[model samples]
Target: MLIVKNIKNTIKYFIIILAISLSLSIQTLKAQEVAIKDIYFHTDISFEFSDTFGADRYNHFHEGTDIMGEQMAPLYAAVDGVVSYMVNPEGSWGYAITIKGSDDYTYHYLHINNDTPGTDDGNGGIKNAYAEGIERGVSVKRGQLIGYMGDSGNAESVGHHLHFEIRKPNNEPINPYNSLLAALNSEEYNPEIAKELSGTINDDKNIVSSSESLCESNTLIKMADYSTVYYCGADSKRYIFPNEKIFYSWYDDFSDVVILGVKEMEAIPLGGNVTYKPGSRMIKMQTSSKVYVVERGGTLRWVQSTSVAENMYGEKWNTYIDDLPDSLFFDYNIGEEIVST
Candidate 1:
């Protein structure tokens, strides 16, 4: 009886210790999660991100997140860190700046516009704190304007965007998406400024017009054939639907079908049209050359537009479709010239 009691007591003590250790570990991990104040500030109201971290680049992995913005848009320091390095290379990364934050994470800002006299690498560049007082070894405060967005180096052909990255102390890349999102949704984020810049309000959930509100609720619907699904918003004034081509593989021959995993529906006013500008997320395609027409309420149909094709693919956009195998071109009439609005 004594031996059994001792064994039971030992097991109970071991379990208690294990639980305490686990609790400490979880607390440590939560503490390690980066906070918004540890990075730069956003002066622009509208925030748009293109390529996400961990995306597949041509032959390598994309180590950073690309924030899409117009040329000369302001770029600020994410945290209070010392400028570790600044270089104007000719090819990849163009004019770049790196700061080692006090939090022991390194922040990278790449492809800044190269127009500033002293900072210009002759490709594209911007003047940052290095001109004022923040150079290598110089400390910087969070939200300090470091440079301007630009299309320098290899990005000149791709247009203007800031390729931002966060790295471990040892230089290993970590995903910056969560950190960026946190900053965008924090109290410091200004919705009015986002509206003024992007003409929209970006919340933690989704993008909506500043004048509009996110649907407080949702309802699911299935088509008569049960082949399609749609989400109805609580407003009763708008409905959200999936892109048909994406959901149904309507044009499998031309390109691979891309399903945007949009779980929540973006609320739209009833009977209003949703327009997509160049580089908008609404424009879904495997490549820039192959364009699809997306209609209101989530219906994607076939339409032809010479101007859109030319703008998207220059003058030789048709070559992309011509290269498709004949067997894959069965669905649409090849000669029909249906103009897209």
Candidate 2:
């Protein structure tokens, strides 16, 4: 009788282990299918969303989601990509930074504080990174610090928070609340709030038709003296347009640029400065407007052009430039001076 009981116990344990393994495998497959894990929280706070994607604003439909946080809180990259557009329009999105993700999605971080001045290239838009070398065409990694949270633009009186949006490759706004929820990976996620604001959960299927004809139809237009490229995607009779400038001329300049990889460095908080210990090697990255010393740290930091030259490069700054054959260089200007907050 005792031998029979031991055999039954062994069978039960085997069944339990098999069930657990199967459950984990199923979850892993689901996560892979969604592709939502690439998105992340814009700020360094809890994933509490104050406003949901597709929520109704006063005049127009709220295309993005809002997260409330303290002013000057660091904003991070939602995915690895290049800085696409940095604009600080008056009485609107305030200081905005848009990054084109490797997956072709454009992530927008809006309503940042107006700390740095605007430039001519940005059409008098506010600064995105505190450092000089951090601009259009600059490569950034996931979770890298890009800006700060603030009530810039129309949110001056509203409160300190971040207005975040995720756009399709064609520049059409997709509901990001689901993506945010997936990023949090929390059990306490409030589906009710998302439903109240967006009117539907997991509504992408309803918004875009599965027909291949609708997905493949696209039209391109050149604007801003051919410096900007606009892509319009057709969803049956309706066309999806970019909320802001999508592709810029400077992107072509990346062909001549060589990526400098650095490892084991520490980044200075608040300021976009990075520090390296003795025996560290540095590389000079020159854009059309400014130069940056690329350092290998926890995160890449583009130290100010002059500061990097003086401190890291010293006298060899000019002579020690990276040698890439047939490299093309161009000069670009920033926007007008920024107005004081």
Model 1 lDDT per residue over 132-250, tens place: 34466777766655666777767867877788888888886776767787666543222122222222111111222122343432333333334444433323323322344332222
Candidate 2 residue spans exceeding 4 A from truth = 1-37, 88-92, 115-132, 186-341
How many clashes in each structure?
11, 13
lDDT of 2 by residue, 1-341 (tens): 99999999999999999889766754443333234545655565453685354444675567777888766566767888999987634445567788998788899888776643221122323433232244778987665566666777777677777888888888767667778776555222121222222211111111222222321223332322333332222222222122121111112232332222122001101111112211122223243343332211211223344533444446655653432111211111122121110
Please give each candidate's TM-score: 0.42, 0.41
In Å, residue 336's CA in model 2 sits off its true spot by 43
RMSD of candidate 2 to true structure, Å: 22.5
| Stretch of 10 with least lDDT, candidate 2 | 264-273
